[model samples]
Target: MIRTALWALGWALLLGGLLAATALLVLRQVTVLHTWHEYLIAAASFIPMLWVPLLLAALGLVLRLRGRWRLLAATLTLAVTAVTAWPMLPAPERSDSPQLAAEGSLTVLSSNVEYGGADVDVLTRLAGPEVDAIAIQEMTPDFEAFLAEAGLFERFPHRVGTAREDAGGSMLLSRTPLELIDRTEGTAFDNLLATTTLDGTLWHLAVVHTAPPQVGAEAWTADAAAVGAMVAPYTHGNLLLVGDFNAIAQHHTMRQLTADGSLRSLAAYGRGRGEGLWEPTWPVGHRIPPFARIDHALAGREVSGPRPVYETVPGTDHRALMVTVSPSA
Candidate 1:
């Protein structure tokens, strides 16, 4: 009797875990945030890699357990993980076109320093001579002072945008001259629109820091829409947008913004891309590996594109994203 009960319990545990994993993945793909429960679980959208551990366990259990049940479990988990990850796969065929004039290139690094607490030294190192522009969120006077003290300004002297004591501040530091076109306060932060000449082409950039879902789902939706609208007008041009979105590309709000086909996500190098290899970039230095990729770069159609580099800084909860954008030649 006791032995039979133990056997039943093991089966229950295995099946239950598989069910939970499927539910998390499916829910993120389908559910629109309506109720409190739906909104809370929306976080599942950020950590799709949750399937990795489940796949490993299933593979291990197949070797340990006898029977067809083990194979069934393994198969199901693999299929689900594959389907969920399918969108991230690369389709480089999509970026090429003759409309966007081949002119010049610009390299930019965008970062969120976790309330301005990231290591100034590491940031300075990452902000090297090759980068043409730097867009930063959660900027503080102290952080600004540190960057200036580090001699970063001498390398990229043109500075435009805002700075705040709180998480609301944002700024664009550029090697070339920057003309501030407009600025908007995001749901809980700052957004700036500026123009700079990159290799003689008039390039426009919108630096944004959206409200995280922690602020509430509705607010996040509003912020995402605002970002989408901000970029929608330029479907094909020299427009580059970058920032810490606190939301993944697959989320409902995120999809809505990118859906119109103007600005394409530059982070989609799923398998064999450059340094941008599709990966998560948040909650860094937390010991647990990052499972959410809320930081991203989106560019206009003619932008011949971004070779992204994701680098980790010691003190921040987020990794710095460096993208080099060039016109198609």
Candidate 2:
């Protein structure tokens, strides 16, 4: 009986590990990761917490060798089912934001405009005084024309747009004066960083849009790590990094950004994990949304801020992320 029980335990862990690895691999694909793939990975993360049921089933199997083998299979099946269902379960509600706003030195908005989206009104509506700077991705030619026609270029004196061919572009629009820096092509993605002076402090603002999900797991991880390593040197100063990370806040890829303890997620302070209105942002027209959090705004260690908020936009599939940041002395 003891030997049988030991065998059951080993099998359970092995099966659980395999499922978890498979989920991780699926999540590396941007499209797959955005849709049902993310839900699977979220469910797998709770396997350790789910060991209780597997253990109970193993006990039942120990009673009879043949019966136990069947029981073990049943147990593994149940474990897989439970993990997939975990993300669907509701978590604790997020705390409400304080009604009164704090006096922060800086405020910024980060968004992926879904390549100009369906209309320009959505972009105009999102711009306001509270947002001192705007970081955006997926800028198409139409969107650039809309910005010029709408006169937003005048408001944000300093801006960078990489819409050379209209597919991939990184932009930074600032109310405060900024100095143009070279735009460099990254191995796994495209990036543009510029030096800006805001409230008498000099800062580096890096805008990055990593490789799409089709790149697969190894490429996704490598690209993410490379992006983190590239920005690793700028931990100091008032740094604000923003864009579509294409990964969740809890994923290992995100952890690579914290070298020198400089990078932190704005959602960490926001209420309810800020998963955004419904999960999954790709394929904007899907009827039932795939739940996920793939967009984010991160800051350097010295930077402090109030909680971040996810704002809904009309045209794009993604929700823009906004935050109030305190300036460095």
Candidate 3:
């Protein structure tokens, strides 16, 4: 009876591991799994770490099995693991072309300050001479006050957007002069739209903070779609949309935002450290490594050499994404 029970348990473990791996593989490819795909994709970011224990369990089960069962388990487990792990592989080396130079570049930093909870010191440190502009979500009244007290306004003289008490607030600060554009049509969210010329090129900057999907599924979808539509008309020229999107790259809404192929993420450009793709930037306060790239800096083809650097902001749950972009000749 003991031997029979052990055999049954082994089979169950192997089958379960195979199924889980297959499901993740499918989820990585398909974006329309359901309305809950956002949450699932967010969870999928951790699959690289999750697969180790899964592989071990499957290998142990295979060792316990015999003959055809062992062979089948081994084949399925290996195949499934490879499929699920492919997306997380280190990115390839990028070319060292001179077109990617930062001589005529505009450096922008986008961060969610967690409603004034982020450390003022870290925030001030990142808003230095290298950064041409700074876009911040959750820019509450107190956060504005902190910036003012810390003399950040003097550093970045030109500013736009409103400071609210809620997470809907957003602000854009630039060293160059800013011209505020009316972007309040067909939306209830607080997003800032402004244009500034950099190196003789007119660039439109949109600071966005979409509604969290966990709060209201339908609203989150609508808000994301609306933001995409709002920016569609300005796809040409040097355009940038940056902020805490509250959605990862794999989320369907994120794909839709860049569906036109004109606007691509800094991650997509693969111009930063490592593979330069899928760097996580959220939940920093939990004392764990970030596992999703929700904050983003997206631009059109006119923008090139996007280098994204994620930095820790003390007291906040998000890592700041600082991307530098130069005009493509």
RMSD of every candidate to native, in Å, equals 5.3, 7.9, 4.1
Full ranking by TM-score: 3, 1, 2
Show how many residue pairs clash in every candidate, following the order shown: 0, 7, 1
TM-score of predicted model 2? 0.67
Tens digit of per-residue lDDT, candidate 3, span 1-329: 89787877776666776677666666656766524645664555554445754675677577677899889869867975785455556445655333343555778888888887998888898876678899988889999999999999999999999888877788899999999884645444577778998777788889988877666556667778877877777877778888887777766678888887888887763455554545567778786767777888888768775557778888889889777777776
Q: Lowest summed lDDT over 10 consecutive residues: which window, candidate 3?
A: 94-103
Give the per-residue lDDT digits (tens) of candidate 2, residues 1-329.
Answer: 89777776766655565554445444443323433343444553332233344444444444334565767766765775565444444434656543433444666777787766734566666677667788878887777888889888888877865663454776888998766554544545566777777556677777767765566556666667666766676767777777788766555567556534678876552334533222333435467563556777788877776555666676777777777676554
**C-alpha TM-scores of all predictions:** 0.82, 0.67, 0.83
Between candidates 2 and 3, name the one with more favorable lDDT.
Answer: 3
Cα deviation at 278, candidate 2, in Å, is 9.8
Q: lDDT values of the candidates?
A: 0.73, 0.63, 0.75
> Ten consecutive residues with minimal summed lDDT in candidate 2?
274-283
TM-score of 3: 0.83
What is the Cα-based lDDT of residue 262 in candidate 3?
80
Per-residue CA lDDT of model 1 for 128-205, tens digit only, reads: 766789999999998899898999889889988777899988899998999987775446788887889976787888
